[model samples]
Target: MPPAVRERISAVTQKGVTLKDVAAAAQVSRATAARALNSYGYVGGETARRVLEAADRLGYRGNRIAEALRRGQLPLVGFVPGDIQNPFFARIAHDLEVELRKQRHNLLIASSEEDVEQEKELLDSLRSLSIRGFIVAPASATDNRHIAELAVGNVPLVLVDRAVKDVQCDSVVVDNEGGAREAVDYLVANGHRRIALLRDDSRIFTAQERLAGYQNSLREHGIALDESLVSISRSTVEHAVEATIRQFSRRDRPTALFTVDSLMTQGALLALRSMGLSIPHDVSLVGFDDFNLATFTDPQITVVAQPISEIGPLAAKLLLDRLAGNRPAIRNIRFPTRLVVRGSVLHPRKS
Candidate 1:
């Protein structure tokens, strides 16, 4: 054939070599060719290979429908987090974006605003997008069934910060229990015998874990756990501040407090000021996860610090690894935390 004629023939073959053409070329039925292409059960390996080779030789480009039915659409990895406005979650999103950019894969980001129904809705949307992998920070109210459904779908999922109970999956988390213990230990060592706990919502995994750590350390030091001194907030800075003042007005106020989060730290500071309490004089406070404003407080806040910038990259890398088919059994990665002592904590003063 002339060069131009040969080119035309090739072009025509490319255009015509759909499942119908592959079936005819391989001396098989169209349904069999489709089954082979889609990796469906009962298609003999030898037959599948022959059909594939024939399709390749014909210069065929598979249709979108065939690709979707066979292997799903273009690849995507998702990140679903609660409270996107929180600085912690924002940092996570930024790092995940950078990491995914390095791999040339797309990201789908969603927020649940700490609502259970919103979380479920976001998950449903991501599933519809055919995302094969996910990095999720479940809402405080998320249920086990919500997590189990993802597992059942065989999605490569990684939990960040908070994890679902009894659901096995890859996770990137901080040493919440250990960090809290360190914070409390520091306070006790400084002679804070009457320590209070300013807790975030009990429904949150981190909050509950940190509370356990606080209680454990108190018990270890022979300090009786005072339920009256433990205040639970809805994870809002305002609510925490109000609760702190209420606790402080009592005749028997705690000499020191271990706050659950940066936002809660703000509330504690406000309460201290409102009640004319001076840091380390009347009450001392320790915070979890250093915040930008920690240094600006009247007495700079002491904090248990996690490597926030590193957390994002680590979680993104785990999701990328799953997308690459490593599929090693679920991994649990815990990062270490450090205690940053500042002017906020001190020895208990004589009454």
Candidate 2:
């Protein structure tokens, strides 16, 4: 190669590949390369193919930040969950990313750790980056001032899994009350009179609904509500285990247990194992959020399964539609839950 040509090539490589380099390599003008790569104006099929091949060979990537700025918008979306450690939230983030990518948008994920202040900080940081939209599961139901402000600002927002009260925006959630009711009703029908409810604190909307459903089911079955049997404010596995042990240590122990979430269910199982009790043979069990571990458990836990796969895609679609200028009234979509009957529950044993 000529020394001048070699120096030009080295300069292009050292400065990082650009659209101009791609256009030169393809023997096309810079505007033609830009139209082909961005799919903006019409370009001949042969020209477009050559431009794309040259771009690939030169490792040329368009500057998304500059393009977004030119359009006066960001090519980014955000998903703020309380805890990404939970399998359900992990699945939501994954599915939402898949959907967002289909629309040529990127997903920015952040965990709030179920802290109100942390969630607020995350939202502020994401907003500073010019995030186009957000799919948030409020960290605390009571403290959603930031979320409310987003709605008031007419930001494209969707609340998933858990929603804040009185914030009118698109939301996707499961039928928590109905699912909890069905789980308790199934236990009651199995002849379990003394049933215990294990769940997190009522500061979360889902927990409050599940607790309400448990109480409603007991009342419907003509069983007196026992406050002691309902364990509230338990978030960690240790807290759940302690609550379970305390309940089972009582003189009139529960014959069956209903846990409102996956962590609590696992904690209850651990507590039972520690006590050397067998499923159904000693105390029956039912739980919410069916997971892979549930099917692998000794008795195969019966659970209320949320449609996690559907929730993420639906929420993304709602936000995308809003961004596309399809502004109907705000919608709150509630997905149905199913009760999978496994071998976890049995008839109450005679004392």
Candidate 3:
């Protein structure tokens, strides 16, 4: 052969081997080689090796389209929160994103602004994007019907923080009842007989659980459950503060107030300060869920601390597990809570 012709043959053989040549060399049907190369159909173990080797030696270029079709879909995880601005939800999202990144999966975050309609709309939007899995903190007042649809659709989902009872799915949550009970128990032990319970509205699962815990503790300790001293406020700090003042302004005011959630804690503190009531001395205080400013308050607020970091990572792992084809029914994994006793909760002063 001429030198130029020889070089052209070498180039075709080495750098530009086609599928026809690979199929011929493999001594199998073109269909078989195509399947083995594109990862479409199953080939016998020995046949698969022969096809792969022939393609490798011939430098056969793969069909990118076929490869994409075989690979199926991109890995995606959705995270929907009641409000991304809320510190608790923000922390959860941060942890979830970090863990999901390690798995080479992308995260899609959305906020519902605590509106039921908004939550349903966002969920639909995420579904439209073909999200592989979900980590959701549902809105407090969300209608169960909307969430039920998501559950019945068999979307791999993990509920974090708050969850609806009928919606069966994997969940990671704090021990709300125990934490609230412990907060009130600590106050009662500190000689606070006239204690008040100010908590978030029961529209949320967590709020309801915490309230039940508070009520149980007070009733269990032989303290007459006074409805007048108990108030349920919205999630806003201002509403909590207003509720606190209203409870405190009564003729027989509570000596210690137990509020749930970090925002509510701030509200309670602000209410006390505005009323010129000193912490521990004038009125003892205990709140649930500690935050950055908890320790820096006038007299550091004692709190029942939820494991925010743990919940986020665990919820992510659960959602990923569901995505991985491990269907062990559904789980409700509840994490333990810790009571951090600080200066804010103290022994009531002698009248």
Candidate 4:
């Protein structure tokens, strides 16, 4: 090649590889190069290969924004979890990323930290990226005007492990109420009436449902609701420890304890140990979500186990369907949770 030609090619490589540059390298028209790169229209076999090779050599990445403008969609999906650091959310994010990757799309994750305002801001910021759709676990089910607004704007949205009352979008959640009820019923059957609940923020939909389940179980069994036995805390081990300590510190200590999530369960374990309470002997324990630590304790912890593996894959499938212009009725899939009974609960001593 001539010095001028070589210099121009170097400039193109240094700046950025454009469609024109790829076309020039492949010795084809811009239109042909585009058709070949995008796999649209009729591209000749040899010419298509040549264009692809040139694109690869040039490290040519197409302008996503420009392509999105043309096609009215971007190859990006947003995931806003209640707390990304939480293992539950982390597992879902992994599944979502794996599922989206199969379709040549990317996942952009942002944590709401269980703040409604932060959730709204995340949605807005992601929207600015022209995200194709979103999978969000709304921070507060009631305070979700932003989520509703997104759905109203016809964005492909899916709610996972949580829901807003008025948002008619796809959702994948577990049967929190039934699961909690089962746990409490088991404790009651074991001759424990003074049960304590270590729960998360009431604004969260899961926490609300679980609380209802707890109350309903107590009422059915003719046990009076003890408001003092319920301790609300942020969904973290540290917060749960403090709440657990407070609950057991009172003179009228609970004979049994139920935690809302795995993090809280771990917290309860730490708190109980510090207070010289032994599992099954001192205080019977059951948690809502099972984790790795559940079985590792001296006496394995019993738990209400949600079908966590299914949640993210199902959510991704729903969002992808929406993005593909499938206008089926909005789906709300709530998977049943199982009560995994272990050595955590036993008959409580007379309280």
Error of 1 at 328 (Å): 1.9
Model 1, 1-351: lDDT tens digits are: 246534544665745656677676666788998878776767887888878876777766777643762365666778888887777888888888888889876677888877778888889887876777888888762465777789767788888998777788888889999999999999999998889898876767888789989999999999998899898886678888888988888898888999988888888888888878898677888999899999997679999999998888888888788778887778888899999988998788888
Candidate 1 — worst ten consecutive residues by lDDT sum? 1-10
Q: If both were scored by lDDT, which would come out higher, candidate 1 or candidate 4?
A: 4
Please give the range of 10 consecutive residues that has the lowest summed lDDT in model 2: 1-10
Task: Residues 1-351, candidate 3: write the lDDT tens digits.
Answer: 346534544666855677767777777789999888877778998999988987776678877644543463768788998778778988999999999989888788998877778888898887876777788887763466767777778888888988787788888888899999998888888888888888765677787888889889989999888888878887778888899889888877889998887888888888988998999889998888889999887788898998887888899889888888998868899889999988987787786
- Among these predictions, the greatest lDDT belongs to 4
Q: In the order shown, what is each candidate's alpha-carbon RMSD?
A: 7.6, 6.6, 8.0, 5.3
**CA lDDT of each prediction against the hidden true structure:** 0.82, 0.89, 0.82, 0.92
Clashing residue pairs for model 2: none
Please give the lDDT score at residue 100 for candidate 3. Answer: 91
Q: lDDT tens digits, residues 114-219, model 4?
A: 9888888889988887888999999996898888898899999999999789888999999999999999999999999999999988999999999999999999
What overall lDDT, based on C-alpha atoms, would model 2 receive against the true structure? 0.89
Winning model by TM-score: 4
**What's the best-to-worst order under TM-score?**
4, 2, 1, 3
Which of candidates 2 and 3 is the stronger one according to lDDT? Answer: 2
- True-structure lDDT of candidate 4: 0.92
